[model samples]
Target: MNETHRSSTDSSEASHTEDGLSGSFEANEDVEKALLPHMDIKSGPQNIGKETSWLKLCSRWPFLVTFLNISLFIASFTLWLWPAPLRHPFKTQDYWKETSFYSPILERFDIPKISRVTNGTLYDTNPPSVLRQRIGKEADKEWHRIGDHVWPLVIGEADVKQLGKDPRVAVKIPEDLGYGSDAYIAQTEVFHHLHCLDMLRREVSYEHCHQQDISQCLIMTMVTQSTPPTPQTDLKTVVEARTREWHFHIYFLLQSPTETAAALALRDAVLRLRRDGAFVAVPLFRVNEFPIGPHPAGSYEIWVPDSSFSDVFFYLAANRGNLSVLVHPLTSSQRRDHETRNAWMGTPWPIYLDSLPSDGDVPLQYPELGLGWSTSPEQEISLEERLRRGAKVEALLANDPEAAPAPED
Candidate 1:
């Protein structure tokens, strides 16, 4: 009986120890489960309370978030709208003697001076040289004496008169006449000249159609001498002489095989007009035969005297076809003359500068910055020479202590 009691007690004690271990494990598990809501395994030490507070603050003041976003947007927009500083392609050479450096180089090198061969006689370019000074001198003198301007209105003369009588007449090119087509270009040229003429007629005073401005009227009213007025009184005359001296170079750019024939016909018509004494027509120059500096490609050049500027302008205005006419002023600088002060009747044809002599002298004032217009004037340096000279000038400036800038305070 004693042995049986001992076995039963030992079994009870083992059961109690097992039950205690299971209860302790269950309690520890419950505690871990409770703590899991506050802990974040992904975001190292838990800042859940701080994050929640921050989110609540943002919710309370939505305007603060909105303001920050708006400020960022405004800053970005301001940066976009701000204008960039002007960038000059060339560095200004203030002290450099451009004329002196270039002139000798041009003279030494037989640079192709801008000269036009018309009617077998080589006419000097707009700015005359010592060799060909007399070529266009007579025309120039006559122009000065009469106080007249030259306006070469280029277009195919209409068989019928009074076509563009109305200044407001809209130019109507046929839909079938494709771009750069002989018929289309011819029609367009006529339309452009007509429009220009109409505009001029409307703006110009009837009495002073020959003169560009009212300076002639001032001269007539103010001066009382058959003899030329003194330098002091002749300020207006000098000003008029400079400004009013315009030469309208009408160029008919021929492209197609048929267009050459058409151009010839137009040339003949201009000759006819000249024969009839309608106007003094400068001889037709085939651009290909005699490639003048910076002249448009595949074009026929014809000039009108200043005497018949108004009449010829009106006549051509009323009757022109697809020719491209480049009407530019005879300014002091040939480079600027073509570039800055010119009007086109039709789309300007790209000049083939590559075909022309590339190594010829260009003016110091007009540097060859790849602009094809930098042709060697009567007195200028070649593009290659100009570049060499430019490098020398830059080197000289760099070495000179005087050229160095003072440090800012």
Candidate 2:
């Protein structure tokens, strides 16, 4: 009877346990059904917890959400508005614009430097020669120093005094010009000629008429002693001569102020023209203080090539101020070149034709630094006596102190 009681009690406990498990499962289903509408399709237990925490934080500090949104908006707008150039802040435009280059071995003590930023445009405004120097290419050496070589077109005695000790130019103050040394201070042909005429007028007045009656004397002289009409020469057939080279002898009186000034001015003009590359071949300008060979009076020589003959000839014709220019050709016969094969600009002066050699080969001699003539004017040989003379010239020039060095590439 005790064993039957125990078995019934066990059966009752087992039925109760089954009923409790079934009830708990039903309660869990009800809870899930209630929460189904609030949960997202992708939500998991961890994700739902995170979303709930985020919502709680936003509710507690409303300004935090606004600040975050505004910060995001500003950052996006700034990124959009940023220039394209600044997008790649660390990138270089070219190899020349290396922003971070260091060479400890090459420049151990040098301060770190960054190349300038360029936008593929030419911003260099320096002169070509200066620019060349900056890039390590040597600038060209001028034929002569312009400042030291050239004289002014016209300058006063006071101004001349200011320019101390320049030997290339010849300066003089006209003496006994009656109008006192200070009164007449012109260094041009026009003014000098006027001064000469005035002196002659004074002399004529002293000899013939009183100083008060000089004006009437001059008028009478002009009317009575009028020059005869010039005889017109017939236009002859122009023949192109067999010429090698040409010389433009700019004749000036050494002591005369006007002629010397004009000559100096001409020299300056020629040098400037050459500097501008106006001549085909650079002409040599040499001042002859003493009369040499066939050239009378103080003269300067412009040794020009056949190619540059016409340009130089026309230039002298237009610009030879109150002075004489003997444009002569170089031919086989030296005497004929001076006397016969010559043209004159302004008043023709008498050449010492007897002094010139009658028959001889006249080889052209260009200036030592003359362009377009010789690759090496020193080593260059003339057609005649080149073996002895040319070698000596080359040696002399090579050893000369003033010779320009070859330009660097």
Candidate 3:
């Protein structure tokens, strides 16, 4: 009976121990849950404080931030608006800059002050047929008459013994001498010499025949150095030393209103030839933009390589029928290139030789020989003038039904 009572007492003490352990575990879990909320609240306020600080700093230095933004905007705007040419302005002005070094020399010689009255009359108003007929008949007679008097002057046989003898005989100086600056003093000397020759020629001619007015007649000769002298080289040596790649400039001469269709067809044919690797077609120039020498009034130029010269020449010769073609060689001397070596397919036209530039350095390769192709100033037709000319041509064609064939016919 005593052993059973002891067992019941031990069982009751074990149950009380288990209940105490369960209650302690529940209190520990509640404390951990309550601390998690405090940790989350503390982290949230810290993040908010960081963001507020940055906003406060910006608010405090508003003017500084605004100034920085404006400075950046101006820098970007300036970079965008700057001109490409102004960035390297010296490159474009290099030619002028080099020429400026000779300004002192030009001023010392009074080069720019010298001038001459050039023959600036245009006698090309007549149609080609009438002009050709007139040229054929009268050209030889006039050439012969001028040749007699001019030959002596050209050969340096003119009598200058009576040069300073006459007080009334004064050497008239031109005020504007183009290309005269190259050989300023030499040109002046030649002018004086020619004036003396003219006086003598007049006297001798009048003695033979008193029919023509000899008083108003004068022979003007302009002498200039073709190229500037090298430091240790003579003219003959320089001329021989010059080497150039030969190029043939073949020009197809055309006229406005009359040969417009033919010109266009020729241009198309030239372009087709270019595509076939035969020759390169050059752009057609306006009347005013034509080269200074005896080039066709309206024409399209084509560049034929030395290799294709024979082929191009033969083709053009056979196909050019009645169309004027001026084929000239490109040489080291611009003057010589145009004046000396040239072949004419049709009627040769008279060129104003005096109109070309007299003082430029000859190029090693052929240059585009046209107005505005060089630095020299030249007269150019404005857009308005070109438009007006086009309108007039259209008006004339419209009035004359026979000028061109109708589209259907």
State each model's CA lDDT, in order: 0.45, 0.55, 0.46
Give one digit per residue, the lDDT tens place, for model 1 in 1-409. Answer: 4345445545655565566765676655644543454332333234556778889997878888789999999999776544322222321231121222222223333444356543222333456432222124563454333333333222221311112211123243445755332121112232333344333333555563443233233222222322221222222223233432334444554556665565566667777887897875554454453334466545565554444556666655454466666665444455444655566665675553222221233322212321223323654345567657756877778767888642332
Top model number, lDDT = 2
For model 3, residues 92-157, the per-residue Cα lDDT tens digits are 234343333222223233333346664322333244222112224464344344343332111110
Clashes of 2: 0
RMSD of 2: 32.8
Better of 1 and 2 by lDDT: 2
Q: Which one is best on TM-score?
A: 2
The per-candidate count of clashes, in order, stands at 12, 0, 6
What alpha-carbon RMSD in Å does predicted model 1 have with respect to the real structure? 30.2
User: Against the true structure, what is each candidate's TM-score?
Assistant: 0.28, 0.31, 0.29
Residue 377 alpha-carbon offset, candidate 2, angstroms: 18
lDDT of 1: 0.45
